[model samples]
Target: MSHSIAHQARPGHKRSEDGVLRKLRPLFWNQEGRLRAGYRVIVFFLLWGYGPALVHGVVDRILSLVMAPGGQWSFGIWLDPVRLAVVVGAGWLTAHYIDRRPFSDYGFQFNRDWWLDLVFGMVLGAALMTAIFLVEWAAGWVAVDSVFYSNESSVPFGQALMAPMVLFIVVAVAEELLTRGNHIVNFAEGLHSWGHLPAVFAAWLLSSVIFGLLHIYNPHTTWVSTANLVLTGFFFGLGFVLTGQLALPIGLHFSWNLVQGNVFGFPVSGKVFYATSLVRLEQRGPELWTGGPFGPEAGLLGILAIMVGMLFTAGWVRWRYGDLSVGRVRLSHCENRLQGR
Candidate 1:
């Protein structure tokens, strides 16, 4: 009689434990036994925010041990790479451990098609900047101050241009990885789990808004600039949504900044690069049209460029894919896992 009673109590306790787990699972884990999208996003951001500072501190300390007391380090050269590594690690860890997916699933599978799209994006970006430069020049809104100008007398012209090129490349890759690759994908997955189609639109809009907000503290930022940056984010995200690849956006971003600030001598989002430029230009047009010291991004001309770019992006998608459609933004992998496939 006592043994039978104990056995019955053990089963009852097991049932109670199972009930508790079922109740608590939804808070942190999805049905697939992976961390919920929201929690994964939170973890990714926490890593992104704090990982860089921690790594940088360690790096500085390591360098200090090897260098003279007063030796100076060139921050511009190393800062971007360090941040890039941190962000890449954050994304990788979040995808592998938390999201239960591959990091390449975040739109970075490099292949022939990806490279082709990237080249096209770069050309398109360069063309758009060239058009802007021509229009401003034709309207007498801009004046050429010098050619192959370097603000730093000690840095050679080639070095000046090369430095900014490398910087812009790093910036393009890092920003796209964090903004479109991680944020948009994660937001879409989270939202999709709740509602289907509306989630896609909401995810895009939210990510773009966040992208703009990230630049809120940039030099000479205004409401108009912020709005324009949001629009710019949408433009950058267009190719990603259509093709599920970062190649287009990353290439476009690189060339856009490279041409805007380094080639054409416009202030990149209001921060003038004092390093070097192929041409030094002076703005004489109305601030409303030219974006003034804030550069083209703050003005009507920038808006026009962005509109044209959008049309071009849509056309490219239609041409390449034979239709304009959203890619794997729905995150079907989670469904596959849930189905045990």
Candidate 2:
């Protein structure tokens, strides 16, 4: 059998036709059975790893909201703390026992490249959010109050900036490690030979969808919220593809959430906050655009914003790394693949 053919073999064994051990490519960067399994593993981890935490968090939030409506949704201050310690420590420990992948393979390495990726992610993430907010205003879906600054939530100058910074750093690192780091890479690598496009697209779609669905478990969720979250997954996935480093996607994810939750004071997706916000907006007008209970991110404006962000990141990636043409999609293949390292 041709090792070049995906599923030509199975896990724990590689079958090569001629003796030229075919190198394994990333599924998201290739087309192979490894791609299929790569996606399955990610969905599994998301369900197993983050699913329980999300569910418990939702239940707790519900109780808290009932007990204290104002401060109920604000547990993220502690919950969202930047735990570089956790990502490195726990991820290292997991690699030691449960998984065979090396710590560095997980995209946990701290280096100059890592920092640059982080910076770009933050700036781009903020820009995307800002762009979405502007669209909302133009649509006349939301009316701003002079008091609220822009109808979104706000905090004092001191806390406003710091809170989001912390949240972004923490959430970005952890989630990226789990989703796009060693985990996704391993899956992709195992499949890359059969056909690269199939594998890559599968990984992208599966991981992204799981990212969105996880949000549905939130205390206050609607179909629109789920739809917005699905788009969010695509946005983050594009970031991951554009900058193979997990750092960039993590940065973007953190910024988007922190801005929505703390800076803007609207529900981040469906999760609301009560902590000292940097700004506050009383949404008055059409529920479709203002996002009503689901928040702006769950609205039409959110869809447009994320789509724009996706395109921008894709373009940047193409510019920096020559386009790796595959069907209608064009991405920087080597840059998007972990093993391309």
How does each model score on TM-score?
0.86, 0.66
Candidate 1 contains a number of clashing pairs equal to 0
User: For residues 47-120, what per-residue lDDT tens digits would candidate 2 score against the true structure?
Assistant: 44654466557656565655654443344444454244544565665554444445665554567866776777
Model 1, residue pairs in steric clash: none
What is candidate 1's lDDT per residue for 193-279, written digit by digit as tens? 445456667777888998899889999999999999999999998888888889999999999999999999999998976548899
Scored against the true structure, residue 75 in model 2 reaches a CA lDDT of 45
> Which candidate achieves the best lDDT against the true structure?
1
Off by over 4 Å in 1: 1-24, 57-75, 193-196, 336-341
RMSD of each: 4.1, 10.4
Give the C-alpha miss distance for residue 286 in model 1, angstroms. Answer: 1.6
- Measured on C-alpha atoms, candidate 1 has an lDDT of 0.82
